[model samples]
Target: MARLSHTSLWMFMVFLFSSYCTAKTVTYDFNVTWVTANPDGLKERKVIGVNNQWPLPVIEVNRGDQLVVNMHNGLGDKNASIHFHGMYQNGTNEMDGPVMVTQCPVPPGATFTYNFTVNQNGTYWYHCHADYCYPDGYRQALIVHDNKSYFADQYEEEFTVTVSDWYHELIEGIAPDFLSVYNPTGAEPIPQSFLFNDTLNSNLKVKPNTTYLIRLINIGAFVAQYFYIEGHNFTIVEVDGVYTEPTEAEILYIAIAQRYAILLTTKNTTDTNYPIVTIADSVLLDKIPSDLKLNQTNWLEYNAEAPHPQADITVEVASDLNPHDDMTLIPHDHMPLLPDPDYTITLTVNMENLDNGASYALLNNISYTPAKVPTIFSVLSSGSLATNSLVYGEFTHPLVLNHNDVVEVILNNNDGGSHPFHLHGHTFQLLDRAPSYGPTFYDYKDGSPVSYDAFNHTAFPQYPMRRDTFVLPPQGYFVIRFVADNPGVWMFHCHIDWHLSQGLGLLFIESPQQMQERLTIPQNHLDVCRVGGIPTEGNAAANSVDYLDLKGQNAQVGWLPAGFTSGGIVALVFSVVSAVMGVAFLVVYGLSDLKFKGKGGGVVEGSQGEGAGKEVGSTTVREAYRDNGDEVR
Candidate 1:
């Protein structure tokens, strides 16, 4: 019996230890402020920073842990909000943090607390969702580690490498001109330089003959980049926070908001430094002007060695690699093949020239505009579909969905330029793609030089690649599928800053009824709208009409009383004054009676018993006073 008791005690202790290790809480207190620093070699400009540090701060957590961030905004007059890119946010939709979509922007001198659970483990990032804020240096890497990672034993150490396209002028200085009506060419503002981890020439030092896991994140606002290192090859193990089958590549093509985990092994040769090159794809560039550099070079050194000769290295672009190829990416774990979709939506994407000559992007002939009140707030408060129409404009497209429905979306890119599309709150499975553009320039619209009858819906693999961001090539179409399980108002849009500002997006209203029951928005989120200078409106540049008409209809009233005259108006004023005085005198008399009664006066107390006697006396006095006044008049 004693031996059995000891065994039971050991089991109980083991259970407690396991539970304690599996669940933990991670918290961070961050202050968002402004600083002037030159990330590129160009001139210094004002940029937003977290904890007064540039490039923000990296957040690392373990799976099944709770992450709580207390963020205070101090960017003078700018409003800001942080979005955890690629996070499933699960039951915490308010913390998803897209300005004017999920909640209001955190105004200057305000604080917001983002608390959510880290259910999935992989690479992710966080950035400001406010217009042009992320491009102005409000971003950081977010890594969630898992004890059962697919390649846990493959590498000894890990490092995060961020690449971006930098500009000389701030977004505010460039947006107005680039989106002006007079700018008919629709030329996007070109970037002036490229950066590696917010530095002009960043170096990744390593030991010889060792394998390192590099987390590559493309946090750029506009261009997609091709990254590679001289004399080294890497194997990609993860993409957009999902583990994938290992695929070897010489160069990686990463789009904005996309992330990849690659294994890099140093050579056994003598210690030397190699060049890490990142070049902006000129295919996405629209009419590049002279004097702009596209290629950026950093260093990968071994044991603090000197840089090797440039002639010994050769740079290559990975444009030839097809992202939709079957062997490129497969699910690390087995995923069941999806059946026929419960909902299928076909969206048409194109550019339209407004009457005012300003360019705007459209989805199904309608441009999305943010409502005065947040959609989440409106839905929760009212639980009405009509609320969506009232808050969002009439033109805002809402893909209403029910819970657990398999949804398939066909994105037809009817534009002349490539767009990097990103979906919030969930990662979707890429089904298939069909390209229409080639050596011959194909028109974007139907009945043109191209025919889309050959859509490749049957060509998808058993387990498709899942990601949050993918390139929608010009004059091409792609299909993606996802289950409508996460309930919220999610924004699906192009990642290009200029294009998003021009309204190339739509809202996916998933399980509105369920969202109302599950979402609990704090008073702090509602308070953001009451604060001054915080933007509550959606992208206004996308509107076809720039101004609103506030005039009301006029009414006419022609007839009046026949005897009305100026002298009659004077007599009417005198009667009104007499009536007002009579009421005031009665009120004073009643208050005095109440005061006398309180002091035990017999006159007021006796009147309560003889009400008729008191009325007779007051009536006689009123009659006498009226007769005297009439005689004086």
Candidate 2:
């Protein structure tokens, strides 16, 4: 090989770039910074923006296109990263972003790149996965175009509709108060307003006699939404990036991180436009504000001149709406349920306060805590010992799985609320769920909770529906199964950002031996850890020499006393400490003699001794007040 001249090299590089672009290499240079946005028209607040654009940019790519995002952390005060939700990053698991799980949070002025191939196609999304990062307008719809879609030729056009709950304040400002001891029962912070397509009173202009593929995604932080169109019913085609057999549905209950694509044929006449309705799931809220608009209205505009009236909600509340039962759906591919699970992970979802008086969500008895080193680095650095869960630390809730094993997850909801759980790498089959959709679906909380018994349950579906995210009903149980074919560190956690912050999640270290063979941590990723003062090697405790030692790993806050609530414990401890210190300070002050301003020969040298005292209000070293109207206390 020989070096080319400057002019020749430049021309050659241009040719290569042109060829790459032609082959569908989609690239985005995102400058992650803060900007102001007012989606609800109520208040303008600071939000995370890409390329200085709020309501962030929607990323579109053809199936199999190599997507490359060169991200720079321009948010000077915050750390950030992006997670391509519903994407199965097969051989490229490092690109799956969840701070402390796959990679370190990109520090201020640092750079990180997300380069991976989009293999599957359907409704998906991308959002900042760093703790408290995405709620502030850092998320957007991600569509993968498939020329060979089953309904590709049946529909004339397609549109993406995102439903979300909006807040007037930044997440950082809300976390301290939301997670404080005063907020027991782990009540989630209620959003200020619900949005349609990131705005209010939006319209999806459509023509009569046209069938459009509408993509619905609930990119919300806390509350789930019920979606429907007045006087219209759509045929459901896909859910969470998995295509399902066409099933008619009049209403849908979409939880956070869930996506649904439906084929909706417009009415033959354009005489009237229909109202698209979205209602917040009030069951998830502890207290709904009187002015917070729960029912949001958009439009399926048949004629721009026609009046678009408000939707007539048939139900009194969101719970009264009967949405389709996802477990009863059949996969378009007809993929049957997986064989009996080779490994079964049975855990309960619990909400309780730790010794610190702050509430935390736990799986089994342990709440999730981020390790000192990223979990991905620990897998790549560990040798044969990667198969051993001991190296991953205790608080991380590490579950080392075998390669290509059939894994079954049985989630028992011990808490009194609903949780939408999502898995990072694979979509599992919805095997069985107790208390199916009907009048009693949302009424599960009124009675004792039902737990799934392996020996007893209804028959599993023949061709079970596959989805990346699913909702666990209130105090009800759900059983799901998936094959562990992908080799990487995938997280199994609740999609609620607030609950996740309280530690309601765990890591699935699948096929560690295979991960060690196929994956290599990128140099740029390593540099990010170094810049952030994070260790890239060692166990979760950052003990490199001895992988089994987890002595210093991060752990959840200690437990409160047996018979006291979080508030009671905090107040007791605070009062006791204050009284003891108050008495000690009183004794010391009482022993000292007072210096009167009239009898001042000079100031006493020390408060403990009676000596010559200086004059009061003097500007000398012994004076109690400064000459600039400042007291020395």
**TM-score of every prediction relative to native:** 0.78, 0.87
- RMSD to true structure for each model, in Å: 22.5, 9.7
Candidate 2's C-alpha runs over 4 A off are: 1-23, 565-633
562-613 per-residue lDDT for model 1 (tens digits): 6644344334534544564465456445644552444555445433554534
Compared with the true structure, the alpha-carbon lDDT of candidate 1 equals 0.72
Clashing pairs in 2: 355-558, 355-559, 602-612, 602-613, 602-614, 603-612, 603-613, 603-614, 604-613
Expressed as tens digits, the lDDT of each residue in 1-633 for candidate 2 is 999999999999998886567557899999999999888899999999988988888999987789999999999999999999999999998999999999999999999999998888999999999989888888999999887888889899999999998889899977876776545556677889999988999999999999999999999898999899998899999999888889999989899999999999999998999999999989888887789989988999999999989988767878887889888889999997789899999989988888766789999988999999999999988788899999998988999899999999999987788889999999999998766664567677877788999888999988989999988888899999999999999999999999999999999999998898998778999999999999998999999899988898898988876898756755664464456445545644554555433355766434535332322212332232121112232
Query: lDDT at 61 for candidate 1?
Result: 94
Candidate that scores best on TM-score: 2
Could you say which candidate leads in lDDT?
2
Give each model's whole-structure lDDT.
Answer: 0.72, 0.87
